[model samples]
Target chain A: MAEHPSSPIPGEKPRWLDQPRNVTKVVWALVAVCALLFLSDVLYEKHPTFAVEYLFGFYAIYGFIGSVGLVLAAKWMRTILMREEDYYDRDR
Target chain B: MTAIAELAMPISPGLIVILGGLLVPFLTAGIARVYVLLLSAATLVYVLGLPSGEHAAFTFMDLDLQLLRVDKLSTIFGTIFLIALFLGNLYAWHERDRMQRTAAQIYAGSAIAAAYVGDLVSLFVFWELTAIASVFLIWAAGTDRSFRAGMRYLIIQVGSGVILLAGVLFHVHETGSITFGHIGLGSIGGTLILLAFGIKCAFPLLHNWLQDSYPEATVTGTVILSAFTTKLAVYALARSYAGTEMLIWIGATMTAFPIFYAVIENDLRRVLAYSLNNQLGFMVVGVGIGTELALNGTAAHAFSHILYKALLFMSIGAVLFRTGTCKGSELGGLYKTMPWTTGFCIVGAASISAFPLFSGFISKSMILSAAGEEGHFITWAILLFASAGVFHHSGIKVPFFAFFAHDSGRRPKEAPWNMLLAMAVTAGLCIGIGIWPEPLYAMLPFPVDYVPYTAVHVITQLQLLLFAALAFTFLMRTGLYPPELRSTNLDIDWIYRRALPAIIRGLGSGIGVVWDSLIGGGRMLVSATIDGAARNFGPYGLIGRTVRVGNGVAWVATLLLVTLLIAYSAG
Candidate 1:
């Protein structure tokens, strides 16, 4: 993960990140980590603050849904709230 | 040091900083910078040396005023404010604008002053001082837009102070006590005070001014601006309204709604502003929980939040400084060039997102635990959701689109060395507090009993945050993620900025029409009277002609006869 100084040579080869295969590999790595964390939930001692916490993979599900819901809801909001960058200035 | 501290006994540290700020304009730019830094450091040293008791007491018109109330709560807030003042000055070292330098010092000093003041009257004075002094930061941007935004910001800020003053007047009249303490929501005075605090805390609909003005400030100005105003309000609220039940729901709403706006916000600084509001919600909820642990959580969170939040603003400010744009649509792949800034930004992001070993984890979880322990199930659920949402926008979205997403073909120079040093020191604090929270916890208003590094806590927090990241990846890969665009997404400020003005214009024209008709009718009546008079008394008419001799004689005779008759009757 060492980062080199960003002095670019002319016509240098693209870095590992520029490769599609490496990109796919990184995505898979993230997926694997997420899966492992979700599975490791069974190893912990139960200390439920609420009944809902006892559900299997509850945090994972809630987090995914909450984030998705936020994005989707915000996208819909753009329909009503979005305006030209100069919207405030137009009247003035 | 003790001698110096004793000599400075009666003068509040805040006043020292204010006096120093006033002297900034007289000094040369380079000297001013060093002088402010030294002044802040000296204030910190003096504040640290003092004991936990009231100092600088005086009577103002028969009411006791304590300018320096040194206790665990005020001490912690004061320490952090001075630290932020030093860090902010360091970050803006290259700034030559006298107004910004002076305003920043005065603003930070007033906030520290607000925190340490022992009574509502003194708090009101410092509170309004913070507002009046800070607006110059916004105006220092010197854009037409910044000017107008600063005006709006000033109005709302000063308006909050006005409300606080009104509340203080009412509370004093009713209770005959000006002491700032747990006023609770038992009376109208307390409610008005809470409203005032709510406005500054950016409670839900009362927020927009924060978002409207912060992004419009100068790069260094925004960094300085972010540290003081709202957090001072949070401190005030914790002092006054602890245990107020309504704040629980208010806090939850404050936490939940801003993430939605932040999700699609194109301006990175504005996104940070929304995130700032969300963080305040956590502190507010802790204040509402009202246990010793909860208040400690609030103080701890405020201390940590000021650093990390400033760190975030500093990073974006650096980007805006170098590239001249902080828009998500305009920035990406900055890590290739600005490695240090990118690393520091990630640290800030991690701290704010409450990663297991970051500042936010140790602080925010205390509030969440308080909610759960209090058996507020629904609020706990909403807070957890907000936690995941915060991770999504501030933690991931901010750094991703700015540094790692699409390459923007922008190869700007790295941030200035002073900015890097400021951010580096701030980032170090974020990590340091995360690793050893004991020093921070020790300074809290109460003893701490919570452990943030529990196995269950770490696992659950990771699951929540990582899953949110997974969701982001999915959206990006599927092309479902909304693209950043150059546009304005309206918020509550729309009412004041757009709708209210439009309504006023409509009413004005309506009134104008009525006024025009009324004036026309009056004009016509006057003209009719003049015309009739001309017709009756024209030169050729009977009264105007020379034959008026007999008429005049008759008139005089009648007048005399009438007078004679009246006199006779009276006699």
Candidate 2:
């Protein structure tokens, strides 16, 4: 077996950051930038006060509820629709 | 202009192009290739120069046949279809197979014809034409698997056309009109049309033919097959029925279901096939939402998808062409030798992933925003999850495994210049549309005011991406990632592949036993009748006994004398 690259430092166990450390850092940085930009748009963007209030309220409640419902529906479908990975194979 | 009109109005020219497709098989390979390309190119020019907002209907022998109508929506789809044909033709120019070339031309012609069709009858005719022409591409592989795949594809596709025909008949009976236009899905006829479109869209359960047949087609054949059929169905659905609440759920399922199959699929081309299904799901969702922005998104997504998806397929085809295999297990470290092909594949991957500054991001975001605008927070969120799933399969998985994973030590030569040229042109479109979407948006059937470059949209999409990427990394680091190997992944196609065939075989045998018993009983009855006849008619029978008649004669005479006396007294 090939030796692991970027092994854990002495007394410091490598977690998600152990391998491809620079790549992980870049990904996280991009994420942070996205979050900051989103917050700025939500708070500072120009809009009618009433419209903003209603839209954001809808986004919060409906988005969360809908996501949960989707997760549940997906789980239910997994039972009925899901099949063995090799379902189409002749040999299987 | 008046003098031009005075001259005999020439035939639609589109018909000529379609008819030319039929003659391709008789031509030599070199001539056929040039003829097919020139015909398609000319058709593209004809469709482009077609006058906008003009609707024409022709009747023959009192049949009132309406063909070749042009509108904004038809123009957009028709134009893109022509471009697709052009690219598909260029990609397949190296293929000397006569059947493939003929099928490709006919497929393009039928799609263009379908777009221009003015009435339901004309639409159905061209719709079935597209189906008939496309199946040859699948069969062109000349393999047992492809034959079976093509057969299933024919059944589902022809089934769709039949359903559409039934719907058209019902629709005409109910509405007393055969003109194709928006009709809500509240009646049986409307519902049937929706189902027909659903089959073509490869919606959820009806989606198996796409994944099953596409990968089984020849390399260039797959590229041509990718362009027309499903997208045409999307256009049809969006045209006739939109905002059907069920489509929302159906579309979401379509988007999400294929990722798992794609992740585990052994064949790279099959993976792309599944990915194609997943992308169609997004377009379906857009149609389901039925807002101006959403509809635009659907059209734009279809446009961009044809580019990048074709690019991806072409790259994989190049790999297959070089190595004679597209199984991921047999391919890795190819990037070291074929850097150009690898780079093109990555561009396709990034575009599909909706990475920042890609075509997918620009178009897909429109639908997401439309969902949010419509107060469909749940639908929007599911779409978000699907976005992440896209990253997992088409975006990351395709590139990572094919290019970087474990280096399987293969040194295949790069794709041919013609193939690379096809990929490059497609890649250029992907980037061009991503950077300047104005031209694409302008071509949409609806007016567009929504900006794609909004701070909120970009930022949220990025956050979703980052988290999804992080999830992927987390899975990999923890050894939870699904390993890439030569394993078959199952989808809805299994119903036809396994269950349906087994049922048919079982039914066949059961019928055979019943038939044997009926035949046995029938033989027994016939033989018994023949035996009885033989016994009565043979020389040993009572009717042939001449000596018995001589012995009875004397007794009869004695009895007759007494009877005659009694009869005389009665008289």
lDDT of 2 by residue, A1-92 (tens): 01123332255444332356554575567557545643544553543212433353332233234333333453344545555544554463
Report the lDDT tens digits of candidate 2 across residue range B91-205.
Answer: 8878889888988888878887787776888889989998998999999899888998899999999999999999988998899878888976888899898889889989888
- Weakest 10 consecutive residues of candidate 1 chain A by summed lDDT: A1-10
Residue-by-residue lDDT tens digits, candidate 1, B46-163 = 9999888888777769989888889998999999999999999999999999999999999999999889999999999999999999999999999999999999999999999999
* Each prediction's number of clashing residue pairs: 0, 1
lDDT of each: 0.91, 0.77
Model 1, global lDDT: 0.91
Where does candidate 2 chain B have its weakest 10-residue lDDT segment?
Answer: B4-13
Interface C-alpha RMSD per candidate, 1 decimal: 4.7, 7.4
Badly placed stretches (over 4 Å) of model 2 are A1-92, B1-16, B61-63, B511-571
Each model's TM-score, in the order given?
A: 0.92, 0.81
- Among these predictions, the greatest TM-score belongs to 1
Candidate 1 local Cα displacement, residue B161, angstroms? 1.2
Which candidate has the highest DockQ of all? Answer: 1
Q: Candidate 1, residues A32-55: lDDT per residue as tens digits?
A: 999999998998987999999999
Q: Superposing all C-alpha atoms, what RMSD in Å does each candidate have to the true structure?
A: 4.6, 6.7
- Top candidate (lDDT): 1
